[model samples]
Target: MPFGGKARWGVRSTVALLAAITGLFLAPATVPATAASAKQSSAAKALAGKYVPVMMIRKQGENLCDTKVEQYQVMTVDALFGNPDVRLMRNNGSSKSTLIKQAPTIDDVRNRGEEAYIDLPGDPLGDTCVYSKDFTRMKNEGEAPVAVYAHIAREKGHSGIALQYWFYWYFNQFN
Candidate 1:
């Protein structure tokens, strides 16, 4: 029951959602070879517009349990991609991270580009309170909290594809 019952849960709707979420829209159907592709892309974008979620964020500066967790921002994957401050890294199998690129694009991520993970600026072993504070500031600087990464995965011998959504957060305080 997401999107306030505006978008239905179905294969076609899912495709539209994918197009919208990924920001990949189809071109015009002027050419004979790309007629179908253009039509589908246009339709998907139109339908996806209704499904965009209106996030409800907690009041900023609100304190609860001696913490200001409400100030955390919920951001989009587009916000993270192409961001100069974010670094895309890959593991070198020796407990070392190799820098693949700075601010990899969504297309790079969708295409399974070189970078497997993104490294934030703060130190992981630093104090929790300090990390939280720095993360909040970082969030305000350019990053938001929630960026969803989705892909269609097909298991071997499986009947259909699985729409997988991975929600990315900057810092997990509860962890």
Candidate 2:
């Protein structure tokens, strides 16, 4: 009966581990929609047309075995369906890894928004590089960038770290 008991215990432990991993993959609905976010939504609604999505990914420094990878994407919204629905395409600075996320909340463009993000290391093999960049700075320098709904974000977990990535939204006077 001791062998039976050990097997049962192993099964229970495996179940518990799976449960915990599943929860980490699920995103919570508690992401706050603040009052300021509401204001920005209104402004983004005004620019709901066609814009382009342009992006570039490169290693900020020497491509060390453990260096972080930096990705930059820009989207131009021009009022499709009187709204923005453009998706972005991206690579992992090497592979054709594709991810599709949601378009900006109207509030994003209204607030004249900007975002700076750092993607922590994901893999334990040291094949992935750290992620960091200034979304606004790239645009301010006239990069003619556009946003992609796909690159907006997705939850990723590895090496005991969880991270979220999303697009930065903005509007220009179309000079």
Candidate 3:
């Protein structure tokens, strides 16, 4: 279920939003290592073109006593840049070499900050949505204040930005 339409923005509430986010128990994150130039190129190649997210992928409890996940359904590979009318790549200096035809709706965004936090739908831990890194940063209208797209490595191999202290070694392992 992709979130349709872009929310009307430009209200200019940086200070207010910051306070609200903090009061809500949401904390900001640090920037990720790995130079911007390298990440930009690589992330673009991996995400801007193709990305998809699944609701569940056979979950398993870390301990033997935990229960196992049963649902593993998938949704359409929705575009994550922005609405069709808005152009996000042009703002980021990536005018060509794209794989997404239409930008994904708000719900389609899987976040693109190095150490920022994006409030995706579902109960935190981001509801397990996966998309391209490039598209995650791709902005629609000057990027949202919450869309503070940066790069982070979450300790070890965790290659995604987040608002909280994501336990890198625990669940974000690529191996």
**How far is each candidate from the true structure, as Cα RMSD in Å?**
7.5, 21.1, 20.3
What is the alpha-carbon lDDT of model 3 when measured against the actual structure? 0.28
lDDT of 1 by residue, 1-175 (tens): 1121223332112112344323233332354536666665454444434444344445546332235545344435556678777787887777888887888887666655554877766575634455456556666675553443344444656575444554445556666
User: Model 3 misses residue 47 by how many Å?
Assistant: 37
State TM-scores per candidate: 0.49, 0.15, 0.18
Clashing pairs in 3: 47-132, 79-104, 80-104, 113-150, 114-150, 114-151, 114-152, 116-162, 117-163
By TM-score, the better pick of 1 and 2 is 1
User: Please, what are the lDDT tens digits per residue for candidate 2 over residues 31-103?
Assistant: 5655665444332322221222223445334333323443333333332112223333234565454432234
How much is the lDDT of residue 127 in candidate 2?
32
Candidate 3 runs further than 4 Å off: 1-20, 27-82, 87-95, 113-175
lDDT of 1 at 108: 60
**Candidates arranged by TM-score, highest first:** 1, 3, 2
**Alpha-carbon local distance difference test for all models:** 0.51, 0.29, 0.28
Which 10-residue window in model 1 sums to the lowest lDDT?
A: 7-16
